[model samples]
Target chain A: MSDDGFLRVADVSKWYGDEQVLHDVSFEMDRGDVTVLIGPSGSGKSTMLRCVNRLAEAQEGSILLDGEEVLSPDLDVNDLRREVGMVFQGFNLFAHLTAVGNVALGPRRVLGLSEAAARERAEAQLERVGLGDQFDSYPAELSGGQQQRVGIARALAMEPKLLLFDEPTSALDPELIGEVLEVMHGLVDEGMTMLVVTHEMSFAREVADEIVFLDDGRVVERGPPDQLFERPERERTGRFLERIASHD
Target chain B: MAGATRPATVRERVADSDRSVGRLLLVAAGALFWGWLVVSWVNRWLGGVLVPVGDPLVPPGAVEATLAAIPGIAAYAADAAFVVELSPEIARGTWLTVVITAASLVVGFFIAVPLAVTRVYGRFSAWVSLAYTELLRGTPLLAQLFVLHYGLNLGSYVPDTLSGVFARNVVWVAIVGFTLNGAAYQAEYIRGAIESVEEGQITAGRAIGLSKLETIYYVVLPQGLRYAIPSWTNEFVYLIKYSSLAAFITVPELYYRADQIASETFRYTLIFIVTGVTYLALVLTASKLMERVESRVSIPGLGVDRER
Candidate 1:
C-alpha cells in the first residue's frame, strides 16, 4: 500500500462474471528490481501480470505505476500500455511482419518515429537479442526460441519503464527455453525492471530480487529466493515447492 | 465361391463399360465444342480475307478457293463467318463487362472493409452490418437490379452527360446494384478472414499500444486479407459472371449484345454459342489472373496448407 514504490498493485480484485479470479492481490517492485510470481495453475498469477498493463481490468484495485493511478477510468489505456510493455507466453509476433517489422511497428506507429529511424531502433533491439541476421525473417520462419527473442526485442523497442512477462518460457520447448532465458538474463544484467510470472524456479533463484509465492489468487509468501526455498514460513509454500520440484 | 463371384464380376464389368461409354461421349462432346471454338476464333480473324477492299493477305478469290478445297472446314468457315462480323461488337461489349466488374470490385472493397470491421468489432452496430449482409445476400441480384432500375428509377437520377457515353443510365444503375451486392459478399469473406486470425494477435497488438482500430487495421486486416485472397478470388469470378445480370436492364454488355444479335439475325444457336464461349474464356482468364495475384501477395508459410 506504500505509494513510494516504483510500481505498486494494492487490493487488486478481478472477476470474470460471477467467479473471482484475483483476491486482494498486492505487490511492489523497485526500479531495476526483478520480482517473480510463482504459483499453481488457476492461481491468478497471469491475471495479476495482465492487470498491471490493464490488459485485463481489475474491477476493484488501485494500480499505481510510478505514482500515476493506472486504474483510473480517465487514463488512456494505450498510453498506459506504452509505458508498461508485456511479453506474452505465446510469442505473439504479427504473422504478416518480419522480425524487424514486428519490433518496428510500435515505434513507427505508436511512438511516431520515422520508418528509417524505427527500423534502425528495431535492428538495434534485435541485435541486442542476438537476432541481427534475422531482421528480414518472419515469425513463421523462426524457431520458437528465436521468435521469443523477437518478442522481447519488440517490447524493448518501446523503451518502457516496466516490462511484464506472463510465463514467457512456458510455451517454449525444453531446449529452446535456454535461449529465451538467456535474453532475459541479459536484460536483467542491464538492469531492466521486470515483473515475471513463471515456473522456472532456477531462474527465480538466480535472478529474482524477490520471489512472491501466490496461491489461490493471493500472495501466500514473499521473500528472497533462498529464504523462501530454504526456510519457508508457510506450510502451503513448502508443499507447493515440493510438488513443483517433483515435476522437474 | 467361384460360381458366386462370376455373376457379380460380370455385373461390375457391365457398369464399368457403361461409365466408359459415358466418358467417351463426354470427351467427344468436349472435342466438338473446342473444335467449334477454334474454328470460330480463327475465322473471326481470317475471315477478313473475304472482303476485297484492301490488299488481301492472299488474293481474295485464292483464299476462298483454298477454303473451299478443305471440304468440311469450308463448311465450318462459312458457318463461322458471322463470328467475324460480330467480333467488333462483342469486343466492345466485353470491354464494358470488364470495366463494370473491375470498378464494382474495387469500390466494393473499400466499402466492405468498414462493413467487415463493424461486424467483427462493433459492439452495438454489429447487427446492422449483419442485417445489410443478409439483406443483400438473401435477395437475388436480378431482383435488386430491377428494384434499382425500375422501382427506384435510379437511371433517371443520373445526368445525361454521364450516361450518354455509356448506355444512358442503365450502366450506372447496374454498377450501383453490382457494387452494393458485391460489398455484402466481400464483407462476409473479409469477416471470416478477420475471425480466422488468432485472438493472440489482437492482444499482442494492444500490448504493443495499438488502439482497437489500429490493431484491426495493422495486425488483423493484413493477415485477414491474405487469408481472404482465395475467397475474394471466388467473389471476383462470381462478379464477372453475375455482371451478365446487368444486361437485363439493357446495359449492352456481352450478354446483352449477344441477345440483341441473336434476335435480330434469328441465329440464337450460333450467337448464343459464341457468347457462351466468350464467357468461358473470360472466366478462365480471370481465374488465372487471380491465381497470380494470390501468389504475389501471399506471405510465405502462412497459407492454409502451410500452417504449423
Candidate 2:
C-alpha cells in the first residue's frame, strides 16, 4: 500500500502478556476522513485506536502520521499525544477542575499558553461545543452528555491533527447520546480527521466516510458505508451486522 | 389492646430505666471532669495572688487565713500554690512542644511529597522509598530520638555557637528525628491516597499530552492530597502527642518540665495530670484546625462532602 495516505496504520499487532489482542491490523485514512471501527466485544478495536497515539504499544507495526513514524521508540510520546487528542468512553474529565479548567489545562500546561489566553481559548472551544453556559460546571455536576462535550472541548482546545474517540457514546444514556453525537457531527462537518471506535450504527452509517468491520482483531471488511452495509462481501460481516441491527 | 402497640413490661421498663441512668451518670461524669479541669486551670494562673499586694480593699494574707480556717480547704490551697508555681515553666515547655511539632510537620510534608511520588511512580526509587518507610516505621519514635541524640551523638557535630541556641543541640536533633519519622508515615498516607485516585484520571492527564511525572503532579496529587486530609489530620494529632518523646532527650518539652516539677515537689499525680490535659488541649485544637483545612480545600461533589 502507498505510504502517501495522511494516516497509515500498517500491520499493527499488540500483545498483553502472552495474549495477542491485535493481529496485523492495517488501514488508511485521508486528511479529512472519518473512519469508524465497528466490531463485536473483545475485537481489539479500542486497542487499535489507542496504538495511533501510542497510548497502547503496537509491538509489531509502524503507524506513520503525516510522514512521521508514531511507533518510533525515541519519539516523544507527549508530543504525539498532543497532536492526537482522544475522547474516552467514560468522559474522563478532571473531576477536580471546572469545565473551563478542564479544557484549559493542556494549553496552559503543555502549550504554555498564558492563563488569560488559555482561558480565552478554552471558553471559545466550550462555546464551539455548545457548552458556553457550563464553563464552571465540574465533571460530577454535569450530565453524562455534557461531560463528554467538555471532554471534546478539551481535545479540541489542543488543536490536534487527529482525534480518537474510544466508544465515545457507549456509556451515555440513550437520550444523552444524541447531544454528544451532535457535537461529533459538527466536528465531522467541519472536516476534523477522526478515528472513532463506536457501536452507534446510525452514526457509523451517516457520518462515517469509510466503515472498517473488525472481528477477532483483524479487519474483516473495509469500504464506503453504503457498500459495506447494503451488501457485505464477507459472511462474518453480514452476521455481525445482523446481530447489531437486531439489538437496535 | 390486641391492636395497640405493645406496652412496656416490668422487666423492659427496668432495663430502659437502667439505660437512662447509665446515660445520666456518663453526662454527670463528663461535666464533673471538665469542671475540675476548668477550676484547676484557673487556680494555676491566679493562686499566687492569695495575698494581694498593696490592695486597700483587702488585707494581705486575709484570703489565706480564711482558707486555712476551713477543714478541707487548706490542702486544696496548698495544691493550688504548687500548680501556680510550676505554671510558668510548663507554659514555656508547651511552647517548645508546639514549635517542634509544627517545624517537623512542615519539613516532613515537603520531603513526603517527593518520597510519595517517587514510591508510586519511579521504577528503581520505589524500592528505596519502601525501605526508608519500613526502617523508620519499624522502630519506636523514642528510640529514633535516642539514636539521633545519644547513638549518633549529634551534639558533637554542632558548632559551639549553634549548640547554645538549640538547647545544646538536643532540640534540633529531636526535630530532625521527628521530621524523618513523620516523613515516612506521611509518605505512606500520600501514596495510599494517590493510589486511591481513579486510574482513568492518569490516562486523561496523559491523553492531554502530559508526561507521566507531570500527570502525577498535576492530576494525581491534587485529588490524592484531598483524599489524604482525614489521615493527615490523624498524623497531626499523632505528631503532637509523640512530640512528648522529645522530652526523653532532655529537650525540655512539656513532659520534661512536668517530670522536673513532679520530682521537685513530689507531686507526681498533680503535675502529670496537668501535663496530660495540656497535651489533650493541644491535640484537640490541632485536629479542629486541620479539619477546617480539609473542608476548605475540598472540591464540591468530589471525594469530600461540600457540607463538611
Candidate 3:
C-alpha cells in the first residue's frame, strides 16, 4: 500500500504450469533509478520484469507502476503496458513495418497521437538510439544490433514511466552488443527509470544504481552495483559472479 | 572485409559476357524445342479434325457444299473472325456471372475473416464457426444452389415485390450459394495464414500496448493476409470458373452462352473453343493482378518472399 517508490513489486511469485519460475520476490525502484537483474539462466529475472507490464502475470504479488496497483483485477492492462515499455531479447520488431513505423505504432494506436505527431516522436526516439539513417529500413534489412535499437526506440516512443529490458544485448552478435548497450547507457545518463535483465556485468556496473542478484527464482542479494558485483556478501552470489566472469 | 578491387580486366569481362551468352543460347534452344513439340501436337490434332470425311459415294465438292449449306461454316468463320454472334442474353448472362463471382468474393472475404478469427482463436463460438465452415464445405455447391433455388424457394415465402425479384433472377440464387460456399474455403486459407504468424509477434504487439483485437488487426491479419495471397488467388480464379456452375441454374454465364450457341448452330467445337479461351483469359488476368498485389504486401524476409 506504500507509495514510496515509483515502481514496486512486492511478494511476487509466478508459475508456468507445475513449475514455479519465481518465488516470493520483492524489490522497489525510485523515480529515475536503474535496477539491473542478473542471474543464471531460468533464474526468473525476465519473468519478474515481465510481471510489471502484466506480460507475464504474477500469481501472488502486487506490482505498482507510478504508484497504481498493476496487479489489480480492474487495471487497464494496455494502459499499464503503455506506462511500462519493454525491449525483448529477440528484438521483436514488426517485420512488415519499417523501423520508424514500428516505433510509431504504439504512439499512434495507444496514445492516440496524430500521425504527424507520432511520426515526429518516433523519429526523435529512433535518432536518440543512434538510428537516424535507418528510418525507412525494415527489421530484416537492419543488423541485429540495429533492430534491437529500434526495439528500444519503439519502447521509448511511448514515453513510458518505466522501461524493462530482457537480456537486450544477449541475442546480438558479440561485435554488435556495444551499440545496443550504448543506447541503454544513454538512457541511464538521461535519468530514465529502467529495470534491466542482462548478463552484461559491465553495463550493470557502470549504469545500474542498484543490482538485484536472483538465483533459483529468489533474490539472493540486493545492493549498490559496486558492492553487489565486487563485494558480494552471500556465498552463492559470490560463486555465481565468479562463474559468469569465467564464462565470459 | 576485403579491400575494394578494380573493375574486371577487358579479357575477363569479355569471358564473362561470353559465358552468359552461351547460357542464354542454351535456354533459347530448350524453349524452342518445347515450342516445336506443342506446335506439332496442335498441327496433328488440327489435321485430324479439319479433314473432310471422304465418302466414295459423294464428291469432295458435294460434301463441302453440304457442310456450307449447314450453319457450321458460318459458325467456324464467326469463330475465326473474333466476332462470334453471341446473343445479348449471353452477354448479360456473362456479366451476371462476373457480378456474382466478384460480389461473392467481396462478401465472402468479410464473412471469412471473422469466421476464421473466431474459429482459430475464440472460446465457445469457435465451434459454431467450425460447424458452419465444415457443413458448407462438406456439401456440393450445386446441391446448395438447388436447395436455395428450388427447395427453400424464397419466392413463395417473400413479399410479392421481392418474390418476383427472387423468382425472376436466377443469378441471385447462384450468388447466395457461391458466397456461402466460397466463405468456407476462404476461411480455411485465412485461418491457416493467421496461425502461421509467429507467436513472438503477438507477444511483441501486446508488449507495446496493443490490445488483443488491435494486435490481430494491425499485426496478425496484415501478415496473415499476405501469406494467404497465393491460396486466396487460387480461390479467386476458382470462383471465376466455378461461376459457370450458375449455368445449370439458367444464369447464362459464358459456359451457358457457349452451350446455347452450340445448341443453336450445332457447332459445338467452335463455340466451346472460344468459351474455353475466354475463361483462360479471365484466369490469367486474375493471376497476374493478384501476383502484383501479393508482391506489394510481401514482407521482405518473411513468408513466400523469403525464398528470394
B1-308 in candidate 2: lDDT tens per residue? Answer: 48888889999999999999996885676565445444443444475353332121233255456666789788676555556556566666776788899999999999999899889988899999999999999999889988889899886787777677755578888889999999999999999989888899999999989999889888999999999888988888999989989888888888998998788879899999889978887786687688789889878778844225
Each model's backbone clash number: 0, 0, 0
lDDT of 1 by residue, A183-222 (tens): 9999999989999999999999999988999988888999
Tens-place lDDT digits, model 3, residues B105-179: 989999999999998889888999999999999998888888887888743454556445433566667777899
The parts of candidate 2 lying over 4 Å away from their true place are A1-4, B1-77, B159-165, B304-308
What would the C-alpha RMSD of candidate 3 be, to one decimal place? 9.1
Strongest candidate by DockQ: 3
Rank by TM-score (best first)? 1, 2, 3
Q: Per-residue lDDT for B8-104 in model 1, tens only?
A: 5788889999999986885676665445444433444575444332222234455555677887789765445566566656765776787799999
Superior candidate under TM-score, 2 versus 3: 2
**lDDT at A198 for candidate 3?**
96
Q: Which candidate is the best by TM-score?
A: 1
Off by more than 4 A, model 1: A1-4, B1-67, B159-161, B305-308
DockQ for each numbered candidate = 0.65, 0.69, 0.71
Tell me each candidate's TM-score.
0.88, 0.86, 0.83
Report the C-alpha displacement of residue A129, candidate 3, in angstroms.
Answer: 1.1
